[model samples]
Target: MLTPSVEALIQHLADGKFHSGKKLADTLQTSRTTVWKSVQSLQALGLEIQAVKGRGYRLTHPWERLNAEQITASIQVPEACPPPVVEVHDCLNSTNAHLLRTASLRPAASICLAEMQTAGRGRLGRNWVSPFGANIYLSLLWRFRRGESLGGLSLAVGVETVRVLRTLGLADLRLKWPNDILWQERKLGGILIEAITESQGQCVVVVGLGLNLRLPPGAADAIDQPWVDIRTILGGGSSRSDLAVPSRNRMAGDLSSRLLALLNAYGSEGLTPWLEDWRRWNCVLGRRVTVDEIGQRYEATAVNVTEEGSLVLRRDDGRRRLLAAGDVRLRVRHDA
Candidate 1:
């Protein structure tokens, strides 16, 4: 229930104009004192409202906030996700590190989102370039008990991420071997799932996801391979800085919901339901590939992924090898 003066201030901020106190008061048919009080309240709510003596208040920068209230309001739930105890941070070293530090105190379903990640990371200790203003940089914390092998957790998350992406109309999104998501031949996004298991019998997995929303300027130089962004998937009339996607908010809500459903489904139904979906979107199958684990390299023809989540392949000598875990690199085929 904003007063007329408060509404006027909001409009002025959105319009990016410098309105004096007298001008704001006249626009709202209110006194200058009321206008000043209203501006004070917005500043209290994490807004960088810069005040000037001659001019009036102005926002320091454009808004890129992902508030829970906004996200929850944007979604219509089929079955409500376990309402994630959401934590919003202006900056962090890495959401994964934050989650791991507070793991014991954290509730079962909690999500940590950072507007800027100072030290975000990726699989095999790769540096994830998480710029301040562009990307859905977050980590989700979920727990499992003793004796649950941590192997297929990344695959499970990959399935869930694809489900979310499919809802956004990217139906042809494919999974590249381990956890990279690809559209056509370019990389879309990647997932990293790291776990901590105690000797007694408890496990906690921090699932970290880095999705390219809008590529920041000069960001492509850092990436060594083919990459894609949301702007690339959609057309190119708009500027990279413009946050005009109507469904962006909805996608966030959908991601949270589907992730919870997948977590619950995995606990109850196991990974049986997701096997076929993975096969349909699998990028490594039928490709010439090399599996590099530790310092050893094994070259094989990508044949299939087993029901137990191991990769099954036939070598050049017409022999089969089952790879339990490794970095799979796809080689170019002359036939293509």
Candidate 2:
């Protein structure tokens, strides 16, 4: 396997410019043949590399290589879940599918991460692109205590996501109701939690996360809402561009460890302790929005997110309605 530095070098050279193999060898302090092998290794990872007579090699586009080992080293147990165990895949139909099949057989705290998901999905059965080397696609298996249902686990997850982004120095990040993370007003990421109830009413929750580290051409068109990628928020530039794109491995490691820790803390404190954090990063609150539940739509001024995570909205009729479970969509008029 190519070391992280070599992998970073591959991405750095992915820019359109022609980079000589000898130059790459010199930069990476490796033999020319070694550089050639590294290039071949990247090709297997789904990157398109071109080798011309004069031009050494160039990537057709950028790709992110997530680090699994780094993530494994960062797990800290704060909840009653199992010890962290990760399974990294080159491709899969869905991380959640894998978790669903293994939940009964496997212990909790098992994680599945894929380089690409052929059939990733979000709430409401929306298609999520799992492009090779584009972003973070992961599913974590957790078993909570029987009959222990936190009122606002989704909202708490959203708040924690913003905290993770802030830990990376990502600013202007906010949370939409339910479990969506936004950069300014553009959708940045989403969370989906699927719970399986056993015969005895025991529950196993599979939390799936999809984050756009980098967006490829045409992928953005599939998303109906306004969205942004990490590259866009950091500034439109290639990994080889002046700023360094953090290692996907480091990102995986840091995010997973921190997420597990948050879950542990949430297990004890519930959502109340994070109310202020959620409020600070709220994006849809106080906005005129449409809350959709069970095919019925209600338009109201986004008033607040209660301690229980239900959206508290003030309708035009001067009534306060607490939406239990619904699709909260920002009204077109509010954005206009």
Candidate 3:
């Protein structure tokens, strides 16, 4: 968490322009020493701050902030749908972790976001590299009754995220089942769904998403897999400074709105409404993949996904099997 003074100070430098110490202190009603300390703090958070001795301070790249008000106003929800409770944080251990712990307190629905995550997480015990203000770290919470199926909820979330990106004119987007986003066969982002099923007839679902807008310097080295960000997607091999990105605030607004709709209708609708679109964006289907389950690995061709959300595969032995809990990975046949 950043202090109010530091937060205010960053805004002054967000325009990617230099601000003199005296000017910043006057604007913040603080002292030049305080302003210098604030700039040091921002730099510690992995932000590239340039201090040109006499030119004052400037962010290497203009900062794009996540504003709760801006996001809320961009959402197009109806009276019955009432937009979700959107909360933005300067830093958090993890958005999903926070929402899961607090979902009981706010049972209706909520979306949590962070400019930076101190302990960002990914599926299967992976570490998601989250640099301050470089990517989208989001978690959305929804409550489901017992009778309403939680099956395919991850798939639903992934599909909706792909839809949102596609609507923004992002092309060649592909969704890997359970929850991985891909663009041109390189990792774009991923989803991690965590839930707590109560003894009663209720469940709390927290879906976390780490969408890469642009990674900071050296951040990509921490990633284990080949990945690409939104900058590469629409920029077409352009330089970082020259790349033009779609309004992140609008994307956040549309993403939450779509997910809320999916959650609201999922109970009654199940996977029926999302089946077609899911298939449209799916890249795993008809691919020779390895399914890892219960300490065993089986090489099979993915045949289809059942209505209940189970993966169906045809083994190399010419037998079909239904997989409920397994991690599927693409095999020899590389995609274009």
Which candidate has the highest lDDT of all?
A: 3
Q: What global local distance difference test value does model 3 have?
A: 0.82
Q: Give the alpha carbon lDDT tens digit for every residue of 233-325 in model 3.
A: 787765653346776787889888888888888877888778788888888788888767767776888878887677788898899988764
**Rank order by lDDT, top first?**
3, 2, 1
Q: Any runs in candidate 1 off by more than 4 Å, and if so which?
A: 1-63, 72-83, 198-200, 236-248, 326-336
lDDT of 1 by residue, 150-253 (tens): 56666777888888877665657888767788877787788877778755567887888888776654555687778877656764435542444324445666
The TM-score, computed over Cα atoms with residue i paired to residue i, of candidate 1 is: 0.75
Q: Write the per-residue lDDT of candidate 2 for residues 89-120, one digit (tens) a residue.
A: 87788999889977878776788899878789
Tell me which of candidates 2 and 3 scores higher on TM-score.
3
Candidate number of the best TM-score: 3
TM-score of each: 0.75, 0.81, 0.91
Q: By the TM-score metric, which is better: model 1 or model 3?
A: 3
**CA lDDT, candidate 2, residue 283:** 73
